[model samples]
Target chain A: MNNEKIRNLKTHAANIRKGIIEGTYAAGSGHPGGSLSCADIMAYLYFEAMNVDVANPKMLERDRFVMSKGHCAPALYAALAEKGFFPMEDLKTLRHIDSYLQGHPNMDTVPGCDMSTGSLGQGISAAVGMAMAGKLDNMQYRVYAVLGDGELEEGQVWEAAMSAAHYKLDNLLTFVDYNGLQIDGNITEVMNPEPIADKFKAFGWNVLAVNAHNFEEIDNAVTQAKQTNNKPTVIIAHSIKGKDVSFMENEASWHGSAPNKEQKEKAIAELDALLKELGV
Target chain B: MAEKIATRVAYGNALAEFGEDKNIVVLDADLSKSTKTDTFKKKYPERHFNMGIAEGNMMAVAAGMASCGKTVFASTFAMFAAGRAFEQIRNSICYPNLNVKIGATHAGITVGEDGASHQPIEDIALMRSIPNMVVISPSDAVSAFEAVKAAISHSGPVYIRLGRLDVPVIYNKESLDFKLGKGIQLTDGRDVTIIANGLMLPEAIKAQEILKEQGIEARLIDIHTIKPIDKDIIIKAAKETGAIVTAEEHNILGGLGSAVAEVVVQNSPVPIKMVGIEDKFGKSGKPAELMVRYGLTPENIVEKVMAVLAMKK
Candidate 1:
């Protein structure tokens, strides 16, 4: 990717981060840390990688994305908002009963969400199903899903991994946001899903790795995944728990804790600085 | 003896017949042979997916395909379909209200030799509790086959509980009138109503005959659709008959009996007796011996009917 393109994607990520902070802060509770961790990847997917239409969200041939680690729905909602799937200002209504933006990604209500997912490990299976459907119909569209590293403790993830490879779903691409920390603590301490690349490889998947924050690396991995035929690809996206915010960086406490007024202002101010630097 | 066919076999036949629809997909969790989904797999190899032994993944996968406009039928033993993969069915299939039909074979004590671990006596309860989930327990082969057709025609998640035992075919194609949520009244009487489903329908029929012999007329109803249960039929039965006896091969706590009772208590409120496994698990035994031991026989239904009739005001 070109420098200007990368810079543009960075601005989208910053805006997504700002939206995530605003959303979780307004809701008074949500997993902001994981949402922040995957903001850049979400930006790359919505703004650059996936072929989705905001106007015709249910287009037959459009690429589908499932937020498997649905706790990070703030990131997905933000990405969708930034990409003009819905109004960006509606991000503040997230997790509220009256708002369509639920705590989890409900595909029925959310304009761009391809699958309803909240319970961990099930979204990848849905993505695999979508890929299988695409193959059945001989469609050119692909299916993408994102999972949290901590979410790997679920047995269904491996089951879905096996199915993806068993069926040779090359059209399916998955990413594990390896942000290290979960709500309990560091995933290694809680439940080690380390050796994630080897595990997926063992499950007959074509495995890749990338810095999730780097749009270039993410783009390259996506290209490689598309190039690889016969086997589904999984990208181990190494990311900080909280990427841009100062105090929230690497903090497990922020996993499900909503930012207070001051914390929200500080987080937004940091993201605003990044936006200013990118001349957005 | 009348023609006997297992509901599971009927379910398999229905899938194979329905495979004529290009968009209909079948998935099995490594129990195609037992669950009888192998019949569909044999005919439409490409359309059928063997999802190994992972029922949860199969359900979620089925949901995904359904989301993409395919009518996906996911089959497995009821133990795994409703018990092991309850959460997957809840969050993935039912919550989204996808076009997925779950053919759960070998439900109840009729699973016999496999014992409690395999028999899913609580499946109907587990399924009906989830919103957007339609639960069906067919009385015989014909109804089971027709229920599959109904499930396909009706969009959203549907759970069809099938049996391992070969029960008597109560209805043939011409005589059967199968609708999604409507219960079929096979016989009408005024003394008491016998509400039954799955393998126990034949028993209820036999019990009705015995009641007639004893000079007590009884109504026989096949309560097939357990979730959006036919409240009108149950309420009408309660009002007219003034007593009810629900017979099933599952636990009395949550199966046909509880469903019928829920309707009767809310709508009409009558004296009701449930003839089921009495909240206990099944042990390794023959289907016939297990049915007798668990009080899922015609004699048991008659006795329950007599007991319920006595309670009627």
Candidate 2:
């Protein structure tokens, strides 16, 4: 992401935030906080970095992305719909019955999704497996996975982390949505995963700290990851919970609660202004 | 004739034969030597992966390989393939219904000297609980070889539970039909039906012959696929015979017996007896001795059949 692309991503980031609020508000149930936080990282990957065919989602050589932080599904769904994986009208179906835009991402129902993922801490392992498969097949494609800061408490996640480093899967890139909030409370107060970068570094991954909200920085990190031939990379992205919405920003209550009628008006107002300011 | 051949060896032989297709890839967890996949590993090292003892990763890696249209056979111990990475098998493989064959050696008490820790008594139960998972146990090396060949040709996730030690070669080397999700009935009898699978099938066959000597005609069916179990056959056996006996090299519960019983008691109620390891973990010993002690031999199947027959009367 250079200066010109970053400008486009800034607009995408704002539209994605608006999409999150409007879609969840329509369904009356969703997690907006983490979605808001992860929007920019996802935007950067989808728009500027990943070597994926937006037309043929099942392309053999296409890059793969797995959202391990599944609660932030609203953000991904918004981005996917905007990218034309499905109808933009489907955004109204988030968490609804018989909807392709499931509350959680399911690979069977969604076209662009590489794997069905909802159980936290497991998706990253799948991404590692995909990356390993890429190496085995000698495919040029890479794999990217996103994890929640709170979901790191799972033991299986670390088991996968250890194995990923052991295999020297350089084609793998993991992003942690360090939003500092969980469903119950702040992650530090619940089960802290602070000093997260050190834990991954100890496991032999090349850890890179990034401003997840900045498209340029994230794109640069991904470009750097491709050059390193023998080691896997983990980008610990620092971000605000509920990034763009004024009332929801840094609030744990927004974890799964959809905005009520009055709250929706306020949230939409904030995102609309942000989108306009970014000229989208 | 009690010629011995290990299930793991038969597995490697089966894969070696499957190598002629050029699509079958063998993946292992550093247990290629133990799982008998080293033969396949040597032939197609490009297709085989020694994921270095990482069971969960191997399973997930197998799933990825399958997603790309390759027929992958991941070999490891039964305890690890069906136990340690149960979810990986469920989510990554079975959920999407990938074509991955899990050749797990050291299943049941048959892998005796490995101790109770390594023996996978609960493996059949665990895999049977999963949807779209095929659980097969070959009674002998000949059938084990055939089962591996069948699994490679079959589409979807198949769990081939094998043993570490050499067992008897019961089936004829020339030919025996062993397709997925179907049972091979060995003999015809109206008096009782003996259903057995995996390491216990040979014992069931032996028991059927013994029953015949006593003028008792017992039906024997080798259940190679646990999921999509030959419900139609088991149902007919229950309705027509009224007495059924299930033998396995697994725990009495959640194995073939329980899976059969679940169908029998529901659609067609019958007196069914289960012959297997009854709730006790096995210890280090010779494989034959352990099989006999665990009551998984032909003698135990006969006893269980008699008990169920008594209930029918």
Candidate 3:
């Protein structure tokens, strides 16, 4: 990837993080830590990797994405807004009774959401299904899913892994946001889902690991996943619990709590400074 | 003796017949043989996917396939589909209103030797509670086949409850008019209404005959679609017939009985008696013996009808 492309991805990720802070702050209660953890990946997907049409969100040939770790609706809503799927001003209405941007992703109401998800361990299976459908229809569209490291404790993830490999769905790509922290605390303390890569290998998936904050590594891993034949690929994205935010970084308490006005300002200011540094 | 065929067998046959549609896909949770989705798997090997004993994954996978313009039929035992994977169906399928049909077989005590663990007496209740879910309890082979056709024609999530036991063919395929949310009236009478579904419908038919022999005219209606239930038919039955008896192979709590009473109490306020398992777990026994032991026989329906008739104003 060129320096300019890298800068563009970084700029999008920083803005997405800003949207996450703004959304959770407005909602009074939303998951920011995990949302920020996956913002870089969400930015890479909507802007760099996927073939999504902002003008026609429901285009049949468009690539599909499932936010398997769906508590991070702020990240998805932010990415969608940034990608021009909907108005950016609507981000403030996150989780409001009348807003389509729900606490979790609802594919029916939300403009660019491929599947409805919130309950952990269920979204990957939907992604596998989408990939299977693409194969059945002989469509060129690919399906992508992002799961949390803590969410790996769900047995359905393994079930989906087995089926994806069994069906030989080469079109499906998954990312595990390996921030090592869950709502309770460290994933190792709560439920050790370590040997995550080997587990995917055992379940017959092509596994890769990358620095999630680095857009070039994400791009390279995605390219390798597309080239892999007859096996679904899982890229373990090593991320921080809260990326770029000063006080919230690596903090498990920020996993589901919204920041107060002062804290929100600090988080947004840090993100703004990063954007300035990127010359965006 | 009337021709007997398990509703599961009819379900499988219907799937195979409908598998001709390129948009149709079948999914089974490693119980294809028992649930009778094997018939579809045999015909369309490419379209049928066996998710290997994971009911929850199979449901969500079916939802995913449906989202992409495929009409998917996901089959499993009732206990697993409605009990083990209730949340997946609620959130992944019903909440999104996907075009996925859940063919839940081996429902109720008629699952026989498998006992309470395998039998899902509350499957109807569980499925009925979910919004945008159409719950169908097919009475016989003909109705089960017709219900499958109706479910495919209808867009959205549908839960078709099937039985392991072979039931008497109650309706002629040529004559049966199977609509998605409509009930079928089998007999017309004024004294009492006997509304039944699934395996209990044949027993209700027998009870209707016995009631007639005893000079008591009874009405018989088959409530195949339990959710989006035919309120008009139920209210009409309650108004015309002063007394009502609801029979089903499921529990009396939230199955057809509760659905009928909900409409009756709201519309006509008729005296109603429910003939079902009395909120207890079923024991392992011969299917016929279990029916008799659980008071799910024609005699039980007859007795309930007589008692309900006494309560009539």
Instruction: Report the poorest 10 consecutive residues by lDDT, candidate 3 chain A.
Output: A271-280
Q: Between 1 and 3, whose DockQ is larger? A: 1
Each prediction's whole-model lDDT (CA): 0.92, 0.84, 0.94
RMSD of 2: 2.2
lDDT of 3: 0.94
What TM-score do all the candidates reach, one by one? 0.99, 0.94, 0.99
Give lDDT for model 1.
0.92
Q: Candidate 1: misplaced stretches above 4 Å?
A: none
Ranking by DockQ: 1, 3, 2
Cα lDDT tens digits for candidate 3, B196-233: 99999999999999999999899899999999999999
Flag the better candidate by DockQ, 2 or 3.
Answer: 3
Q: What residue pairs clash in candidate 3, if any at all?
A: none
Candidate 2: list runs displaced more than 4 Å: A1-3, B20-23
Model 2: which residue pairs collide?
Answer: B137-B198
Model 1 Cα lDDT, one tens digit per residue, A156-274: 99999999999999999999999999999989999898788889989999999999888889999999999999999999999999899988999999999999999999999998998
**Candidate 2 local lDDT, A27-56, one digit each (tens):** 999899999999998888787777777789
